[model samples]
Target: ILIGEKRFRQQSEDPRTSPSHQPEAGITPSPSPRPRSPDDLEEGEVEEVCEICTPPSDVLVVEGQVVEPFSTDHAQRLIGQIMVLNAQIDRMQEQIDSMRYRLDSMQQEMKNMIDVLGRI
Candidate 1:
C-alpha cells in the first residue's frame, strides 16, 4: 500500500519538487554521504513498505473506493453489543446448570420415595 502511494506520489511529483531533490530535514547536506532517492529503492523494499502500510479489515466498496463498511463508532457499538450478548449467554448457561442440578436432586428424592413405598 505504501509502495503504491509512494509510487503514485513519485509519479505525480515534478522532478524538481521531489523530497529527494530537496535538502535533508533539520540537517545540512553532507558532501560524503548522499541522500537516498526514491529511484534507489529495491523491489523488496517496496514490498516491505506495502506489508507495513496495509491494515487488517474486511474490504467494502463504497462508491468507487474500497473502504470499511462501518464507521469506527458503529464498530465500537457493535463490539459493546457483542460483549453484552456474551455476558447474557454466560448468565443463561449458569441458570441452565443450576436448574439441571435442582432437577437431578428432585429426581433422586422421588426415587427415594418410590423405593420406600416399594419396601413398605
Candidate 2:
C-alpha cells in the first residue's frame, strides 16, 4: 500500500553556497570528496513529504481471479460481497441451531422411552 509521497533532497556539493566549506584567506583548499550516487543518500537526507491519500486495499479478486491496483469500486464490490456472505452465514447458523434443537428433543424422547421400557 502506498500511504504517502516520498521526496528526496540531495545535498549540494557547491562550496561557494556553503559557509562551512569556505576557505581561510592563506590556506590551500582541500580536495573535494568524490560524488555520491542516489543510492548513497543517508537516512536523514530522504525527506517524507506526507500528503495523506487513501491506502490501497489488500489484493482483490474478480470472477475468481486475483486483480491488481484495488480501487474504490473494488472496495465497494468487496463490501457488498462480504455483506452477502454474512447474510448467508446468519442463515446457516439459524439452520444449524434449529437442527440442534430437534436433535436434543429427539434424544430426550429416546431417554423417556428407555425409562418406560425399564419400568415395564
The numbered model that scores best in lDDT is: 2
Note the clash tally of each candidate. 1, 0
After best superposition, candidate 1 residue 54: deviation in angstroms?
Answer: 48
If scored against the real structure, what TM-score would every candidate get? 0.43, 0.44
Give model 2's TM-score versus the native structure.
0.44
Please identify model 1 stretches exceeding 4 Å from their true place.
1-69
Q: Candidate 1's error at 37, in angstroms?
A: 92
For model 1, give the 10-residue run with minimal summed lDDT.
Answer: 50-59
lDDT of 1: 0.58
Q: Candidate 1's residue-wise lDDT over 2-75, tens digit each?
A: 23322122222346555544433433322233334567867556323321121122123468777677888998
lDDT (Cα, tens digit) per residue for candidate 2, span 1-120: 113343322123343335543434334323334445556667557533343322122113367656588899999999999999999999999999999999999999999999999999
lDDT of the candidates, in the order given: 0.58, 0.59
lDDT of 2: 0.59
